[model samples]
Target: MIYLQLFLSYLQIGAFSFGGGYAAMPLIQAQVVEKYHWLSMTEFSDLVTIAEMTPGPIAINSATFVGTQVAGLSGALIATLGCILPSCIIVTLLAKIYIQYRNVKIMQDILGTLRPVVVSMIAVAGLGILSSVFFLSGKFAPALSNFNIRGIIFFAGALLCLRKTKLSPILIMVGCGILELLYQTIF
Candidate 1:
């Protein structure tokens, strides 16, 4: 039953997660956090952190972590396969279908409509990721904002480091950890 759930959960995520792996973030968060309650918000944030730093797609890493958390190693293996099964079927089906319908007007129209939604989903995922990192610091409803400027700087620094330098992402993560400790020490 758990294995079936693992398969179905990821199959849904995989089926609906458009715009590639990065765009899958919001879907994962929604299903895992909101729908299933399988992961807490903090855990989700940490999952994103580890996923970004680790060597796989966010969805796959999330499946592994959440699955493990839910049911240990066996769960992890099951969930990972669940997450990937749709892709295996999808690529195969698309490859076979595209040859016959590559220039079809309906296909073109469908893809056109999908492109914007996919793009928005990607942006929404980015915002969700940023919010998880910053929590409710930027919420505007009651106008409560308690952003840690130092941490924001560190986040920006990570981007700059990646763009301007060749420092590995792992090193940047370690550097950020060090910076967090130092920020606490100094402040």
Candidate 2:
């Protein structure tokens, strides 16, 4: 039953997550965090981080991680297969259709319309993570008392490094991890 649930849940994610890995974050959160209670919000945030650092798509990595957490190796296989099956099917069909309608104005317009929707999905995912990191309650609502100063400082520093220097994101992540470790040790 658990394996079936994992398969169906990821199947939904794979079918509906249209834009890319980042755009799929909200759908993944909806399934694993909000609906199933398989992972807490903090775990989801960490999953996002780990998924980003890994080589594959975030959605696939998330499916594997959550499956492993929930069941075991076989669960990981089922969840990953479910997550990718839609892409395999859809891309095959869409490729033929796209080749046929590549220059159609309606097709171009539809693609243009989807761009903003994808951007909004990515923004929501980013804000969700930021809220989880920077707020004590891990919610969108803000309270001065519940704000995390260290998280904000790290965020600012990371933003500054990204904008002002050519430092790679992996280096920034490592720097933040080291800084957090030092902060934990010192204070």
Candidate 3:
């Protein structure tokens, strides 16, 4: 029964999570955190971090993580299968249709329209993570007292590095971790 539930939940995530992993964050959060209570918001945030740092898509990694937590290795396999199945089917079909209609106005228009929606979804996911990192309460509502100054400073510095330097993201992440560890040790 638990396996069935995991499969179905991930199936829904895979089916509707358009525009890739970043866009799927909200749906994954809804199922894993809000619906199943498998993980807390902080855990979900950590999961997102882990997922991003590792290989493969965020949805698949999240499904595997949640499934493993819920039901171990077998659960991870089932959840991963469920998460990829819809994408497999949809992409195959879409590929065929796109190859046939690559130049059609309607197809172009549809793709154009989807861009903003995907961007908005990604932005929402980013903001959610930012709120979780920056605020004590982890809610959208802001409070000056709850602000995490170190986190904001690190974020700003990272943003600046990305915008102004040639440093790799992985290097930036490593640097931030090292800085945080040193700060914790010294302060």
Best by TM-score: 2
Q: Please give the lDDT score for candidate 3.
A: 0.92
Between prediction 1 and prediction 2, the one with superior lDDT is 2
The TM-score-based order of candidates, best leading, equals 2, 3, 1
- Compared with the true structure, what per-residue lDDT tens digits does model 3 show for residues 1-187? 9999899999999999899999999889889889989899999999998998899999999999989999999999999999999999999999999999999999999999999998998898899899988876787556688887788899999999999999999999989989999999999
lDDT of 1 at 103: 94
Off by over 4 Å in 1: 136-145, 160-171, 184-187
Q: Model 3, residue 174: displacement in angstroms?
A: 0.8
lDDT by residue for model 2 (8-77), tens: 9999999999899989999999999999999999899999999999999999999999999999999999
> Superposing all C-alpha atoms, what RMSD in Å does each candidate have to the true structure?
2.7, 1.0, 1.4
The TM-score obtained by model 3 is 0.93
Better of 2 and 3 by lDDT: 2
lDDT measured at residue 97 in model 2 versus the true structure, 0 to 100 = 95
User: What TM-scores do the predictions have?
Assistant: 0.82, 0.97, 0.93
Candidate 2: TM-score? 0.97
The per-model lDDT (C-alpha) reads: 0.81, 0.94, 0.92
- Residues forming the 10-long window of minimal summed lDDT in candidate 1: 135-144
- Candidate 1 lDDT score at position 143: 41
